[model samples]
Target: MPTLKTLQPGDEPLLEAFLWQHADTSMFLRSNCRAAGLLDEGARFQGTYVAAYINEAIVAVAAHFWNGMVIVQAPVHLAEVVQAAVTQSGRAIAGISGPAAQVEATKSVLGLSNRPTQLDESEILFSLTLADLQIPPALGAKQVQCRFPHSDELELLCEWCAAYNIEALGQKETSSLQPACRQIIEARQATSVHWVLVAENTLVSYSAFNAALPDIVQIGGVWTPPALRGKGYAKCVVAGSLLEARSHGVKRAILFTSDDKQAAQAVYRGIGFVPTGEKYGLVLFEG
Candidate 1:
């Protein structure tokens, strides 16, 4: 039987090494640890980490974050580790995310499989090495400028975020998502993680690195307004933002999108992203 326990302060090196083996599916867990460590410090990125071990080596890891979300990267002994994650943390799970099969197993163990949620999805994971990134013709030709959003653009960015939450995720309650959208835009305002594509002095699209590490980034919150859809601006902003990230030493990028979104998937493929043969789950409860 595997031993399951909560992670401690000094377990960083081993935990990180184990997580790196599952990097694409472990972004939330690894990024949160990098930002806030194992202790649930009552901060944005802090969480109570749990690990399952076999013969003293970690075989799986999970965390129940301060925001009431659970993310796991359990490759073995799924039910035991997931159940321990919830029982040890004693936190109400507002949602859960991770590898598709793991998330389902987690919800099953936690009795959340039947719970109603605003969004529940299993999306195909895609990734690219920045060196293979293909710049959109319009971006390379300077037909559109890619730049970070201005501090004054918070409200606009938030609005676009809300739209993204609705259209992409199938979440209906915009009001419930507004505060989070605003907070993210405000918090990341001074960072290069968020990028906007402007044409003729007007914003046409938005793309952001929702999760970041020294060498890898996960793209999310991509939105081109309804009026701007079907014009290839989506690919432009993504490729342009990635080019900038590459210039600054980021070596790779990953993202997950619904399988029904064939057009969007094709756009990403056109810019050198290929399916990583992994699936990620996302579930957000309605408040």
Candidate 2:
């Protein structure tokens, strides 16, 4: 039987090794850990790390952080690790997210009701390799300049980030996200990369690297206003962003989008991202 262990202060190397092993598929878990050490630190680092071991060999890892959201990157059989972590932490999680079946199985073991406050069932995971990057052609005769947000544009990026949360993640009541978003913008500006698509001095689309693992970076918070859809801004911005990341020595990029987001999927595919798996997410409220 596998044993569950809460990572300690000195376990950084062990956790890094585990995450590096599954970096491509579990980029979120790995990147988040790298961005913030395995200790609770407000919104970004608000979590703990749990590992599952079989006879001293680490086989699975998870994060119970930020509103009790548990993100696991273990096999289906090891879901008990997630349940045990949640139960031990005594935190009423806002949600659980990961591979589809794994999330459901963990939820079951945790005795969480199937009727969650919010559920996203159609998340498709896609990844791109540095092997064959197909940079999308510029949209048209109209030039779309893609670059990082200037200092003065931080508020504009925050608004787009909020809109992304509300529209993509179904976060209707996200007054709390403003402060977190501000922190996020600052963190990204300092540690990671942010890319924006501007047409004629107007922001049209946005995307950024959420985490940077040893050889992989996860792309997230991609958004374009409804009024600007179907014009290849997403494709252009993503392509440019990937190129920038590569220039900085990243070897791979991964992103998740709703399954029905055919337009976004098309944009990703056009830039060499291939569907690899599905992700599941649920939100529970504190009663």
Candidate 3:
């Protein structure tokens, strides 16, 4: 039987070892957990990290928080460790899972329905094998340039990101994301993270990669300005960023997007991102 336990500092090495064995599924979460750990130390947000141990061996892990709504990520086993995690939080939990089967299993266990929504059903997780990545030649009327932001561009980058988040989250200007954006900018100053900004004569979209692990690089925070939609800017930026990952000796690149956005899904497929499987994003509501 598998037992679920809270994550602590002493478990880092053991968890890291588990992650090393199951890098494909755990890489992204591990990287995010490491970043979140730093944020927790700074008192940014408190998080509950848990691991599932089977016969004293770590098999699965998850991390969540009690911010306004409960948000969980990549719950490998929704019926097992995930349910325990949600129950412990004592809040309505929302998360992403592998596929219809796994999702339905979670729903049946939790007594909920798989009502897909714009935010909830967002992109299927996609990946490209490093050996399969084809570096397409730069083309078209739109110029594509990719670079890591320097100290001088940090302020402008943060401002651009704030605007991007407001539009993406569909929240008003007063949202707390403003400071979260600042935190990300500050985090980039450290060597563990990389921020790639794609500019077409000006900053248009940005993508970030956390390089805590040597073999896998997770792509996240991909955003394009509202005015820049349908201009092929997203495709250009994604391609450029993937190319950069290859240059950095990364063997795999992984990312997720809303499943409802067919156009964005097409864009990822066009650029060679094959859907590995479905990933769940679960949110817990506070009673």
Worst 10 residues of 2 by lDDT: 278-287
Query: Whole-model Cα lDDT per candidate?
Result: 0.88, 0.74, 0.59
TM-score on alpha carbons, each prediction: 0.95, 0.88, 0.72
Q: So what's the TM-score on candidate 1?
A: 0.95
Q: Record all residue pairs in model 1 with backbone atoms less than 3 Å apart, i.e. clashing.
A: none
Candidate 1, residues 33-143, lDDT tens digits: the string is 887788776688888888888888899988888889988898888787777777877888889999999998888888888899988999999999999999889999999
Worst 10 residues of 1 by lDDT: 167-176
Q: Candidate 1 or 3, higher lDDT?
A: 1
The number of the candidate with the highest TM-score is 1
- Per-residue lDDT value at 144 in model 2: 80
For candidate 2, write residues 202-285 as lDDT tens digits.
999988886676567778888898899988898888777887778878788888777787888888898798987656444443
lDDT of 3: 0.59
